[model samples]
Target: MTNEIYMTSKAWPFDQARAILRRLDIEKKRGIDRGDKPVVFETGYGPSGLPHIGTFGEVVRTTMVRNAFIALTEGKIATRLICVSDDMDGMRKVPGTVPNPDELEAYMQKPLTDVPDPFGTHDSFGNHMNARLRAFLDSFGFDYEFMSATELYRSGAYDEYLLRALNKFDDIMKVMLPTLGAERQATYSPFLPISPSTGRVLYVPMKAVNPEDGTITFDDEDGTEVTMSVTGGNVKFQWKPDFGMRWAALGVDFEMFGKDHQDNAPLYSRICKILGGNPPVQFVYELFLDEKGEKISKTKGNGISVEDWLKYAPPESLSLFNFAKPRAAKKLYFDVIPKTVDEYYQHLDGWSRQDEKQRANNPVWHIHNGTPPDENPPLTFALLLNLVSAANASDTETLWGFIKKYAPDATPENSPGLDRLTHYAVAYYEDFVKPNKAYRDPTDQERAALEDLVKRFRNVSAAESNDGEALQTMIFSVGKDHEFENLRDWFKAIYEVCLGQSQGPRFGSFVAIYGPEETADLIETSLAGNLS
Candidate 1:
């Protein structure tokens, strides 16, 4: 009953959520009644490299859509979300993260499941990568079933599908051949025979397939011909065909992939159709890029690592980053983290004040998996950044002491949200802020602007400064007058010229929380070349 009330109360027809629910409804009617099965949602991970931010983005976004479907169905729907690791895949190249690259040359083209663990921890490289992937997602509290292709094929879970693909070899080949280059077309086959001689997965063109006996003949790297059974870990479908086969056998109803796979969409769909399965309702999101605008990669490691970001920011902020305009390619680097954290705080503030029905579009609602927090964090990330310096606080107690002075009503017990930010702010200050605190002699125009802005701030009555909204407005107006292009730079100057870094908390909130009198002194210090 509670679920129904929650579902019916929110605005339906939310862009992504509505689209997901609509497609899920169609799948239930078509696949369950007509096609005869439960709906499945699957996301694949290539365990060839250590998992990175992109890996998490896929799982988080897909789970979000799955959660929305579950909400709209009000527990009446039965669906499963699975994260499948392609641990059976062969390693084409060694990942940059792994050690002894030259050592792995010997293992090239070997199934990842067969390669030795480079770290000497897990049974194989695949298991090591899979363990890290699972641990990372578990840290974020995702609910998912983990499937290993190594186990799936070795245990014969994919045996029936493998044999069927072999039997229908000609049909699968017809769907795959046109996509290959002329050179590839001549040797193209839908199956890679796992060599019994070298115990390696051979990608060489299949010489023949004895469908009646379910054996595949292929040339080994040494120019020797080998025939192997299509079942029992002896052979596997090539990736495109393998993807479609998973959907057919597993009953996948929905999937979301990155744009790098966009070119393969048509081919994948045709393969799924040829296999008598409908490709799930799909979305292709853009890739995550570094500040240089290059795609983030497991080997390149161009963007922030998962555990590193979690160290300074909340997981919810990372979730917000993923949720924010996912269709557009965005920088997934440290420079984006402060802004994402501030945005998370804004949503929390919005959620606390808005009427329940109005929060249908509030990100905090989605961030919390549709149930937003009952209270907002007392301090924003930007605000806490200021408190760290204003109070010269090296620890929580000292920070709380300053908070109580300006926000007299705040107490540790009542403001648990701020409590979390306090720790992050202090650490961030030491790591990112404190070391960079140096005096930047403002340009004549910048110096004039800073002086005038401080004058206005000093001239304001304590009562006016006490008004949070009014003080923030003054800060923005003065920022533009000083030649800052945007509020971002406005704060950047405030931190760089005044606090000695490129960022800090929301200026107005920080001033209000830090007391207007202390803010005046901080500004004076900046103008006097004493920011250090």
Candidate 2:
């Protein structure tokens, strides 16, 4: 690997915001050179309920660009991944509707803003949601500063910024109201108002004070009652400027947000300038749609959650989808994921085989069919899945040794590597590919092809040929109707013959890479229903 990646490609097709960040980095560094760290970027998220794969996508892309920035400036400048959970934003309703809403009934009728933490120990409902997201980030190996809105408010980090925005409330409001709808502006009790006729600003007054019955007032016009029994305490400013005040106090350099928060960015920018903070970095990613093409949101309850997808799929499979495109509107379903995941990784593998110079510029965006011939073994997850459903190879050491012989580049590190492999294998064996559950069962056509292919494969020796390409081509020859309509049809056919199912793996190449006898044995056991 070289320190410099030649631009074999101009830029990654999926990331325009990254290109913007790179340009901004040059400007940021001019400031950093004079002895300022210039915290380069920050992104905001809401912890109202269960986090989704889309959430992971936002953070992962942020982290990758941060890594690029750190690389670009040679470590002179610093960037941080600040996961700001808008816990202080009023909680509208319990997201999932727990069976025991009564159990949480005590928390109702309070400012729908601050409900009790579902996990019971956290100070508020927002904290509970933030904790869930934090757990997922930790599981994904992201390094970030996890901050809760409630903590920042209680700690008074936003005190100075808040006071400044409050003082300039009228000026900031002039810039804010035109952005809200007329009807919204009319009843905009909690929002900053703008003149409908002139779009001139009218600021909402805000302060940090609690009323007699435990209600908290923003500016003395109207106050929200604090649910003291459910949550231990309550303290907040009006939501609009609170975010702007936050951007300044946190030194957030860059943050990517979903489109739902598009209106808030301008307001936050105004508040950032008012509070004397740098305008935080901002990128607006699109939404994740449900199988039916509806946007996934707390109100819709329509999308598959991150936890749900993780149940029967590989982490990288999820990564593949998120990384494959720029954040744009796309349809997703829990079903038929393996077909997509296999194709994606194969495409990645092809990219790895591309000419080195081309591979350097955009390492992650290479097309699979063009990947350079590198020693990088397939992800342990793909290999293990093939083994689980192809043959009865249970010994991790044996598998590792085989991997060393074939692709000496493969590393057997920690449980994550193992877990990743186990997950993919589960998806393959189950033949179903949703977040919650997936099970594999070979079709009649697949079984017939596998039985024939296995008989042909037995005639060859384990060490005779190791080239994956030649092996794949040879297997394709055995099926008279070998012309595949797409990658899915080909993969399904391979799995069928090898494991007595329509799809299992690339048999010829898998056997060559994994070895002949082991490959045969795996297929026999999986087909016999002994391995899954």
Candidate 3:
């Protein structure tokens, strides 16, 4: 932490963005005063399974910090954002998310880069995963340079670092042993040698290390001593030292990982310092869980895939999901889609209304990489969903009619953004909302109140009706008149009994988008116990 972080009294955006910038500024200044080392930001990817939302979240969140750093630095400093893939890691087990689990059993404990691609597309399983990870990040237009651990180690990119670790094996063991069980502590080795016998990397205990000759002599499973040079692709590291070694070797300035790694990240920081290297500034975000708070993972295959989310909502909502207070674990489920979409619009709404200083605090500003997109599609996803139900719209043109009615400035030529959102809204409604929609029998009090509202709507022509805000006010007035004190229950009844959910968008905007006449028809249909 630096004093630049606490200078929010000066009206800077006081959040993760500012803190990231402040930390980078402190590091950059110290580095410059010393020798002007390049500031490097890194996010690691585990290519053990197919990429998911959590995979996207880390890079996206890091990019947010990178963007914030660049904004505060005004492009003054050189920065490198690196995405490293641990493809060299062994395929310990076949991930449930992947195809043909049984086939991978033969390759268990072999380096991932050597395991055959079950999909038969890429040369190896690790290569397939690496390609998929790249495609995933590229889909979101993430600005990052990709590095392969397989290439790095096999080609001697990490040879110098590998030798350093070999020479300091005892020191690495000192840093790593306390956390291990007594059995593990007795056998722990900082380096795993590629076994000459089984032709797979072995975690067997080292009998001796020749730093002078760059060879590690380790005992095989049969207690046969085998000596292999640490150079070439013969050696890779266990994770704790691997992390520290990479940071020291690559000059990583900052990085972030999950809270589950909370205990482990610091151990790497310590090992890095022991290796005569400074640790990267670290941030630990909470882990991702399903809607039920169950842990999300590749083996479980329990959480939403990146494809399903982008199919249902705009990609910007994903950014908004990442931009929230990262320390808090959020539910990354389909249920969160509507709220995130609406919140993105809310930030856009604030950006238009707030002055330049305050707009910097807006999440959309950071999400868009400091240039907020033009305020278009001025409707929320929840409201659009309600409109889909209100008009019973099956396609875009019908929805466009309502959009054009609400915003006369919208035209087919200019409203491509709205067109895309309309398509997403219709698909989301049909897939997630419509099938679950059931007609709830209206209560007697509710029936009478809705009956009165219908009568009022019957008298008011579509052209002469009050706008969304007025229509919203009048509906709430019916609830208040009937003494339904809980506005939440009132809205729940309106949405569930009418729209077939416990909630929808703001009623005023929903009514405005669907028009008062259509809303009346919807109310009348629900009141009459018809879900047509």
Which candidate ranks first by TM-score, i.e. highest? Answer: 3
Q: In model 2, where do residues sit more than 4 Å from their true spots?
A: 1-35, 95-100, 109-119, 189-241, 263-278, 298-302, 313-317, 334-423, 431-507, 510-532
Ranking by TM-score: 3, 1, 2
Candidate 1 lDDT (Cα, 0 to 1): 0.77
Which portions of model 1 miss their true places by more than 4 Å? 1-36, 99-104, 353-357, 389-392, 434-438, 442-465, 469-496, 501-506
Q: Is 2 or 3 the stronger prediction by TM-score?
A: 3
Q: Estimate each model's TM-score.
A: 0.87, 0.66, 0.92
Cand. 2 TM to true fold:
0.66
Best by lDDT: 3
Ranking by lDDT: 3, 1, 2
User: Which has the better lDDT: candidate 1, or candidate 2?
Assistant: 1
True-vs-predicted CA distance for residue 309, candidate 1, Å: 1.6
RMSD of each: 3.8, 8.6, 2.9
Model 3 TM-score (2 dp): 0.92
Whole-model lDDT values for every prediction: 0.77, 0.56, 0.80
**In angstroms, how far off is 320's CA in candidate 2?**
4.0
Model 3 residue 530 lDDT? 77
